[model samples]
Target chain A: MNIRIENLTKSYGDQKAVDSISFEVKTGEVLGFLGPNGAGKSTTMKMITHYLNIDAGNITIDGRSVRNTDMKKHIGYLPEHNPLYEDMPVIDYLRFVAELQGVDAVKLDDRVKDMVRLCGLNDEKHKKINELSKGYRQRVGLAQAMIHDPEILILDEPTTGLDPNQIVEIRELIRTLGNSKTVILSTHILPEVEATCDRILIINKGKIVADGTAETLRKTASGSQVLRVKIQAPSQDEVKESVSQLAGVALVEKVEGSENRLEIQSHVDQNVNEAIFRLCVDKNWVLTEMVPFETKLEDIFRDLTMN
Target chain B: MKTSNATWIIAKRELSAFFNSLVAYILLISFLGFTGFFTWLSGNGDVFFRKQADLKVFFMIANWTLFFFIPAVTMRLLAEEKRSGTIELLLTKNVSDRQMVLGKYLSAFLMVLIALAFTIPYYLSVSQLGNFDHGATLSGYLGLILLSSAYIGIGLFASSLTNNQIVAFLLALLLGICFQFIFGVLANGSTGWISELFNTLSLTSHFDSISRGVIDSKDVVYFLSITFLGIFLSEYIISKRK
Candidate 1:
């Protein structure tokens, strides 16, 4: 029903590919594993699936140790590569996976059929896998993983090679799947995590450094907000100086333009909007535009990881 | 689930690939052609063929025929999956390393059996012409099954070792031929533990005994060793790949 890891570490020689990191995903909960390249997201998924031996630590799935064969029965994993038997037909491939997961012969056909329908691969079910497009191939990979209806689904970079449209479709699929399955998915795309996950785990240097809802993390990570203001006056240097003197204004810099614009940076604990509006009115500086930058997940990710 | 179901699933896919592929057909036809030519050439000339069908001659020629084709057929078993990045999907699907290796091995091994079955017409023609050693013919086919399976196992192991199908093919060939011949040759020049070891490993010698219509326990063990060793190695390589 859930996954829990305690002080998990995986080292390749001296480098800790997956440093001591721990987090949990509740049943029917979607946890976005966010990280830049080499942050050990895939390594973490691999360790959880028992595909890679942990250098140190313990991991459990739904209260059962990941090492137990019983736990394997309840798990489904899609590796980042989307590797498959290209020479086989799509349906044949699914049936093979189903049998491996111990699906009974009587139910195997129905199981494969359900996956094919869910992944939208019905049209290409009989075609040779080698002939499918990248999107279709990814669909096949998804179908195979879900054919057994596992409780825990660990997907690593599921959208890496997909196009924009396919990315959206797959994202939609994951969201639906997440509603009924415990999902731990790793992706570097910031918007994707925001769109599909309930909670976010941001990993940096192989360790999870931040874990929270996307909105909450963005609130704290964006220590200061920038308001791009445009005024009617030819020169807004007077307005800029006035805004800089405001109580919450951290910095006020003039943007090069006869358009009368300034980029206002703010500090925590203060809203500088009131002071900026007062200054503009007092100076009779016609405020053409006042746009406050909303907190973006990309900004939060960069702030946490790129340091 | 019982392991055989997993094995059957893999075997079905593998066997379909074998039949669907031009390579399997090419190998089968070439095998029949070479063995047929050898059987014709030995007619009325070899002692056994003077009164009966030259099945020993047929099986002996089969050894050479498979050397070229079996490697080609089995090369892509595991190697292609690795190359195309499908091995990951296979493992996470609840298939153990043993099931994966055995399933593929069973698939390729079945191809050899089917191709051998196609050669039944030759036996029919021989029986109509004269009295053949019926027992030897049956055992010869049995020896071929064991020998080809051993080759398939070796090829599967080689395939698992690399993602490149060509590399797997070459590796399978080298190992297959080594098992079939080198141990026999090496056993000749030495007279000690080394000689005994090589003798025990000699594939052709065991196969040759079966060619003469005699099923020896040591020979059976020899063939089984090669088959199991190859399969075990395939599992070892695949497990590390994860």
Candidate 2:
């Protein structure tokens, strides 16, 4: 299933929580919804899942408006806070959710078993939810959301409480599922998005600030190329002066507390690698290392979301 | 999914939740014990003391006991769900708001029905003791069911108003008191159209008429209307989030 949200808006009394946001998620696409707290990621997911009323906009699933149609069975949602019945056993809760999602009675047991195996809940399937640790509970939450084989999965902080091994396992599961399903997940963890999502969307203050893949975001974030170079030369000052004089080299300065390494910044849309090598060959300065430094996702995220 | 199927699924979960905890057992034993003591063992209103075969004393005592008990049975139905944030999970499923309210309302009503069913022995032994007005006895039970239906509606509506169980219980009781006796009291002190209006609105008048072996459609309508109103208001409150 595909989701198309156009000009969606929600408000709390005098304040607009989601302000005229529009986006689209196609089939077999994993969209990482990145935003700070109160950035309307959860609100948009809720509207798509039919959990909240749209104040002024259209949310259509597969070309059908969600306001007029019931799209819940097609979309599985793990809401923020992962609220669940604390007294219900893990297996029973999964079955309950499957039934609510309209899973056939004949296939109910098979579905529950598949979820337990898929979510690694075989050891604690019979224990009440309250007895499980936070990570196990989070797994239970994921298991229930996917039990009915929904075409679209909306997960809010899906790995909030998991250990490193569990996080990797869940990410693998999501990646496998993304091959055939549409996934919109929100999280504060930046690398998890790059690890799982095909596209990253950064929203701040209820509006979309950036939307593209990790590579494109990096390119747009910092247009200039930076290289860390270490050289064996007669004099560090002579090497720096010679490197700074090369065409396309915007700036060159020695790395602090380093004798032979210098940082070089290139102008926009310029490549100074060949020029630097040619200069080293001409000046008798042996360049030992030259490493291109790409802008990090963290820096891009901060640059876009921060004032 | 079918509406009734969804409603039944939700109601079944709620019923099982009641049984899994101590709430169901405590409610049953206390309800049976309270009604049984007044009907068969009490010195003042005992069947022997009244020299009556009809379960009028049992009906009267049950009417009061259920007024307090139904709120307890219904307090956590929606309130606890809201407090724990599970309402978001439940509502986003294939279930509609009206179906959710009806499902919870049905569960509480079934609990009351089960409690009332236990009192069949009182009717059987009372009939053995003397001549029994089967029609009046049956009508008395019907009156109790109808009365409970109305109270459960009110209790659910109160539960929908807030996330606190205590507030739900108190709000239910406060709303119930008006129909239970305040309207009747106010009617007794007035003598014009307002008195007649209050008299018609009071649940006591309708319940008394039904328990007297008179199956008036007016009384039935009164009870059913209140139940519908409660269910409708709860649905409205829940759907307003959209």
Candidate 3:
């Protein structure tokens, strides 16, 4: 199902937990929610699930307002911290969630079996949730959220406590599910967004700061490019001076305590790679290494979220 | 899911949770032990002392035991869910706030029913000794069930108001004491409209009338309204986040 949120606002006493923020998630897309702690990502997801009422504006699922319709049946939610009934066995908990989601009696058993297989909980199905490891418990949380095969999945930090292999497996699973369902997952892992999400939304202080694919967000983050080069020249000072004088090269400085390394920063919309290569060849200096530094998502996130 | 179906599903899970933990067994054993002692073994209200075939002493002891027991059953219903953040998971399902409240209320009510069911042996033993007032005894059991419902309702309301089980228990008992005895005591000590109002509000007066084979609609309505108000207030508090 498609989700459209418009001018949604919420407050706690004098503080606005979620301002008039708006966004949309299309069907068959995975949107990664990125924000620092207390950035309102969870608040927005809660509002989408209708767990929290929108103080202002509204959310619509496939053109129907959530306030006017019981959209919960169509949306599967994994709350933050992934709370589960620790006293119940994993299988029983999954069945209970499926029943609460209104899975039909005739197919409930089949659905529960499917979730067990899908979430890789077959070995631990009979054990109580609290007896399992944190990674296994996380899998149980994911299993219950998808037990009824909901059209939309809203997961708050889905891979918080998983190992590397499990994280990769879950990302693959989410990617597969995204082909036929709308998935909105929030996380502190920067690479997880690029690995799983079709779009990235960065919100800060209850407002949206950036929205687009990872590539587009990086492209808009900065106007200039930086490159580090190691040249076998007579002197580091000579290399820095020559690189600084080259056209399109805005700044050049000798690498701190390095004998032959220099950092070159290019002007906006400029390419200094070819110019540096030619200068090296002309001056009889051997260019041993040159690496272009692309803007990292971490830097972009920090730049956008940090004041 | 249908409204009632969601409610039942939640209630079923809660019921199973109660059984899977030690709480249910502890409550049953203690409740039976306490009531069993005072009804047949105690010197004051024992069947031998009363010299009556009816279970009046049993009913009176049950009223007091259940007043304390219902809160224990209900204190963890909402408070634990809030503390562990499971309330968010449950509420986000295809269940409405009213369904959630009613489902929890049903679980505690069923618990009280189960506890009461275990006392049937005491009734059976008393009846075998002599001719029992079956009409009055039956109404007395009905009155106990209705009174337990009112206490469970109030207990659930108290549970919904906070995330601590201890606080919920204390608050439920505090609220329950007013109806259990304070109002009745005040009515006896006062006069005029104040006494009349306290008398009407006191739960013991209605329970007494029903246990005596006086099945008045006024008494039934009184118990039903208190239960409804408690359940209604719980729903209102839970949905207040909206």
- Give the 10-residue window scoring lowest on summed lDDT in candidate 2 chain A: A66-75
Tens-digit lDDT string for candidate 3 (B76-181): 9989988999999998998888999999999998888899999999888888989888899999999999999999989999999999999999999999999988
True lDDT of residue B218, candidate 1: 78
Per-residue lDDT for A1-307 in model 1, tens only?
Answer: 8889999998887998888898888988999999888999898888787777667888997677887745677878888878877778999888878877888889999999999998889899999998999889888888877878888888887887789998999999889989999999988788899899999999988999889998789777876778888877646566666778889989887777545778888998678888888877888878878899778888778888886
Q: Could you give candidate 3's per-residue lDDT for residues A77-166 as a string of tens digits?
A: 999999999899998998899888889889999999999999999999999999999999999999989988999999999999999999
Candidate 2, which segments miss by more than 4 Å at Cα? A257-259
Evaluate residue B236 in candidate 3 and report its C-alpha lDDT on the 0 to 100 scale.
Answer: 93
Per-residue CA lDDT of model 2 for B1-242, tens digit only, reads 48898899889899989999999999888888888889888999788898978888898899989998999999999999999999889888888888899999999998998899888888888889888899998998899999999999999999999999999999999999999889999999999999999999899989998988899999999999999999999889888877
TM-score of each: 0.91, 0.97, 0.98
Model 2 per-residue lDDT tens digits across residues A100-175? 8899999999999999999999999999999999999999999989999999999999999899999999999999
Q: How good is model 1 by TM-score?
A: 0.91
Residue-level lDDT of model 1, residues B1-242, one tens digit each, is 46677678778877887777777778888888888877766555442455555566778888878877788988998988887766666665566778888888888888888889988988887877766778888888888888888888788888988889999999998987777779888998899999988888878778888988998887777778878998998898887744
